[model samples]
Target: MHVLWRGDTLQRLRLVSGLILFTFAATHFINHSLGLISVDWMHEMQKWRWVVTRSWPGTIVLLAALLTHASLGLYKLAGRATLRLPRWELVQILLGISIPFLLLPHIINTRIAHVFFNVNDIYVYELAKLWPASAIIQSLLLVIVWVHGCMGIHFWMRLYPAYRRIFPLLLTLAVIIPLSALGGFAVAGSNVAAAIEIPSVFANLKVLTRWPDAAASESLAWLRNLARIEFGAVLAVIFGCIAWTYFARVAGPKVTVAYTSGPTVRVPQGPTLLEISRMSRVPHASVCGGRARCSTCRVRIERGSYGLPPPVFPEVVTLGSIGAPPNVRLACQIRPEHYLIVTRLLKSETAGPEDIAIEEADSAGVEKTLAVMFVDLRDFTRLSEKRLPFDVVYVLNEFFGVVGAAITEHGGWIDKFLGDGLLAVFGQRDGVEAGCRQALRTARDVDLALDHINAKLEAELGRPLAVGIGIDAGPLLVGRIGYGESVDFTVIGNPVNVASRLESLTKERDVQLIMSRGVVRMTGWIPPAALTDQVSVRGVAEPVGIIMVKRGRELPADVLALRAEEKEKEKPAAWTAGFWGRR
Candidate 1:
């Protein structure tokens, strides 16, 4: 049997199933908490059970879905070549194993008993006995199962840009939900115990008072039988869906396509080239599934660009940001409208550190470039340590927001955030003069923001904050770099490094902003008072000229006068020394 291994599709299935299971488990926990209110509330849950199970078709569908999900999970586990999995994977496996064991007995005791023995007193008798003794076990199963499923969903959602911001919030909710459910369960258990002691009170409950007589009515019996049949049909439909998807994958048409480097043969009409590549035994990287959220699967259309559809929205956004060639596309987003030839740019199955780092090096080798800016936060480590985790996060967000806004406003793109620093490139999208002016304007804006941030923090935390910035202009290499699974577009070479180093010197020089002579010469917009001679840097053999910038909406007249007076005093001292020597 030719088993089609649609890894991407299978991953997506796992994501969907995991999300469904998580949502269901969350609701189940909340329902269990209702037990805290009173046994009647718990007993009321049976009504919904009937609704969920009333359609035989729905029950059958759920049963099949559960079975297929479990089977696929097992298949994935067994197919793994390496025993060394990630810590999260191990956690998932352990939880997966425990769930069925804990849940199976509960399912058999309730659903199976009702189906075969006509025993419907699940809420009153069975749950009371099992829950008290196995409360810890049940809670454990609930936590593990829900967490496992939630983690899977979180992993999948990380692949999309829109969902990235919500990832942490979703994870936080996952933890909060289980705790709330457990609290409710405790309350319900106590209520159930109390009600059990008062038989008179319990007998008056609606479910018991309206108990169905076994031989009472043919209509009631017919309804019960119909409900069971409907439940079975539900299960059947779910099974059919899984079966159809599997058959479709296996029976799909196969095609051979030539890659720039080689050839791969696989089922045609896949949602992505990565899917086809994986099935064909061609090595490919999909760090974030095939969502086109990450550029790990970037490939150039060598000879068959016309055979593919125009780039999708995601592909266009990601590729455009990274300045990819018009023919370049993400393998995960490209579906073959026709036979095609492609060349993978990044040549590794896993993302490596060199992917981003090497790209910077490559960009620095370019001939003519625009502007580069380096921003370093002042005393970030000290500030971070003084604050709580949440506070630190808030502060960093604020800092990044301000700097990012400035960069983007001036038509520049951020290369990367280096801990407490920021590196940005200008001119690749526009022209050289525009890039230079943008960098300068961004520096001035940053100074303005720092004043505002410091004022706010001073009021809130009784402290001030500062940052130092540097701008430089030069020719450098700029391009994307990475092997198969990881890649980024960044600037590289000495100019980029020097810009960073210049920012570092600002603290000792007492300058809020500094620009290299290269920038002043290229832009020809240097202020006369701001210009300074070559200053010694740590590494380079020669000194580099710079322009020191002071904060303030405009340079203070008094501060300028003080500088002039100091220069005058120095000249008088030199003259007096010369006169004394002559005498």
Candidate 2:
């Protein structure tokens, strides 16, 4: 005997079954729209409907889908960590569960009526059965069922890039189909009512009254009662399951889950961290609503994970697919039985629908504004030419250590090291303003750090070492560049090219640090109006304005005053976002 409880399999089964049900619902809605032409046209469409839904093959598939979708839904419901979800998700769940109850009466009157009582429920007979109360009930079911299916399709398709493009057109179709069906049905009802009042005009009136015999009418009545009783029983069971789950949780041990986001939540042992977050009203990222289909709710276990429950098959699959580290786990799946400390990987405060789109775009390669900085070790080759190879390596190591600390302290990421220098970038995590600000700060820090390094290494080097730096901030193509194994994540464009060229310009211009005009504008920085000059960059079409820092880290008293004024004018607290918004 073989049984599979894999999370991916279960998820795929749920999707397939739900889609099957949606297909049937779509066909029924389309058939209802045929009433716009004539009630006769609707009746004509019923022949195909019967062949599709009433035939043995169609009946098997429809019933299988209903049973499979419903059972899996309830199974998922019982195992859920928390009932609290986003509004749309909650509404979709309620509508999905309500489908069977709403469809019970209508199904009993039509297909069940046809099978047991041998009654043909055409538009006339169906129209009579749906006059006052039943009509409103059916109308509610139509909207609920249609909207439920559409929502499922939406959540499924939203992850796809192309889906966003055609969504408005799809939304228009979804609106038009249902509204047209209601209008057509209302118009058909008026015509049927007018005919009913005057029987002399229509000779054959079999469609008006479906109850040909007392036995058939009695059987139909019995089926209606049975359907209602079944609906009541289902409601009782669902509510009962919910109550049992609540009490079962109440009896379980309590667990404390600590977050890096400054909150510690205590919940019953049964629920996951996501459930705890929702129950405690803490904002946590779970874009897939804790289905384990997304890594948004991933957290690193900081402490007390030894006593926590191991990942189940579904959770294991999700974590494995994302190439998650052993220390990291999805908060939606981990049900801690003891105290646990966890740090959420994604920002809960800023993560939203927009973030999801941005993440997708990044994976597909997109342009972003970044601050690029190039560092060149000046006079190193001339000094190293006189030293031993071992002494040269030692000096290079000292220089790298000094500048590396400075770069990291100012929030710069070293992309790669050139033989004698390194290229660093800022704003991979933060936005333009912060990145630009950090780059300028690093230039100052590196100059100071090198002074300390040179003083300590007076024996290894005859004189003090100096480095030339060039920085520029602007929009660039940031993505994975290269093929397969040789691929590298890099930011490339005019900004990067100009910055590299400016580093070379540093020695020619006899300046310790230089920057393109764009960096100053981006940081809202006002450098002193000193001997600012223009230099033609190699790849650029025109000459670019340059900010020359002649005295290294030492700015004149006037330049310092202007910097203070710029800081007062544009405080970072007052201006957080630059172009794409601070990440």
Candidate 3:
């Protein structure tokens, strides 16, 4: 009971064991690929590999990992309150369970025969036996094992910040290794078949003496049959445990789960809210497939919240990172032991792979000094009042296109579009200093882009387009917020609100851009004393320090020139701080 309940430790052990087994499988496939050159090459590589893997210590470690991983996997599955899972998770599980059945027979014939019956079990001998008869099964074993290992690796690796950058290379190797191994096996098998046709080669091969005697061959057969029976018994016991757990949960007690969305379901006790939602066919978001890495599956307990167990470590980390309130809990982590009314925080239909693909800086969430920018086109509404609806929409899309491009180009993401305005946040992945510098440059680019747009629309429009830009930099609580389809990954704090106020102030102040003093300072630039002012901002108790620019294009020439010189001085230190140093 103690061992089973320590889920975090068991999960870590399972990951370690899985990685060890994956390494072995990868190396074995690489050895098999050597057969592409010649069967002798395969044997040569195998001999080198055997130095570690075929040794007593290596064998013991390999067997231990195999047992640990298999048992842990079975236990994890049996512990699941519901069999319903994401498509990829279900596929990985099915493939993992299928591996032992296909693999045990092969292991018995080769490793067992080598140790007990003194069979050579060399590539040529085995290939000759396997060529046309056992080829399909061996191929299946190779693919199933590789895919299962790769999926497990994917599930684990995707949680990291660097996984996305290295994924393409990983995917290529995954595909190439298995195909090369299968190709090598086919070529080697053909060579063996050809050699066997020659009387001299066949005699030298000693195909009949591969097994010591008829008795040894009969004994190998009996061992394989017994191994199959033993494996079957183990599987049967695992399934029996799962079935007993399910039936016991059903018969022992029942609870009513009332969803705020108006569905009240009577589900058996034991399943988590997520499992219950799936069982009841309710729409609930789970971007990390119930792993608790993403808090998209969070639900607010509307009623019956008392007596609930505390969140586990993973859930605590995720919820704390996102700054979730006290009443909210991860649906995937908590089992409703009693009747409870809950509301899903995110819409399942709107959640996608991208929802879990958080950036390096925004893994869950935390406080970071970031540059927040707000851009709004001035008087586009009045311009649209006289123009055709089609023309208005067309020009608006074009306006947004340039704005979006400039935002992304300057290392920020457009958090959301506000009809004629948009919010962009920087330093989410890059640092605050870079974000401030980039925001200044983005303002300049937007001003330039508008000029080009105005030139193109000169005949259609009586006047040129105009825009206001605002930038602020400070510590902000950055994370995903909102419910259902309206969920947004955004920053919230004084800085964000200040930026919005500054953008609106641009119209009254008659300027193209307005930036907080902190933003200018973060960029390593001192604003001109004459251009700076202390002004009262709506909703803010104190006056805010700001630097205004009448025209963005003129401002960057002075600001970026000073920055360029500073960056030149930094080149030496920057070179020392390469990819890893950036972190």
- Tell me the whole-model lDDT of each prediction, alpha carbons only: 0.63, 0.73, 0.79
Q: What lDDT does candidate 2 reach at residue 526?
A: 75
Q: 1-583 in candidate 1: lDDT tens per residue?
A: 0011123556546655665566567767767667656657766885785577447965775676666677677665543322233455568776775567666656655565556545554456555544578778877877878887876665445444446546668767777778877877777666666676687765654254343345533434455466556545654564465456546656886555667657656454544677667656676655544555556577877677877878866667666656677888888777775667777665443243223222212212335476889998888888688778888777777888788777776566677788888888766544565576667767777778877777767676566778888887777776555533244455676668778888887898887777787776655454675347577766667888887776623433332232332242222122212211111
Worst 10 residues of 1 by lDDT: 574-583
| lDDT by residue for model 3 (1-583), tens | 1211222667768878999999999998998898899999998888888899889999999999999999999987878887777788899999998898888888888888888877788787778778868889999999999999999887666655477668889999999999999998888988888888898888777655364477987887788788778878887888888899888988888999998776999989888899999888898877667767666688888888895798888778777766677888989888887889988766675454433434222225567788999999899888889888899889989998888777766667776778899888776555788788878888988999998899988678788999998899889876556553344456778988899999999998999999998898887777678889988887789899999999888774655553543353322222212211111
Best-to-worst order by TM-score is: 3, 2, 1
Please tell me which predicted candidate would have the highest lDDT against the true structure: 3
Once superposed on the true structure, which residue ranges of model 3 sit more than 4 Å away at CA?
Answer: 1-7, 207-209, 212-215, 218-252, 261-263, 285-298, 311-328, 343-365, 369-371, 380-413, 416-420, 426-465, 472-475, 480-489, 493-498, 501-583
Worst 10-residue lDDT window, candidate 2? 574-583
RMSD of each candidate? 17.8, 13.8, 7.6
* Per-model TM values vs. the true structure: 0.47, 0.64, 0.73
**Superposition TM-score, candidate 1 onto the true structure:** 0.47
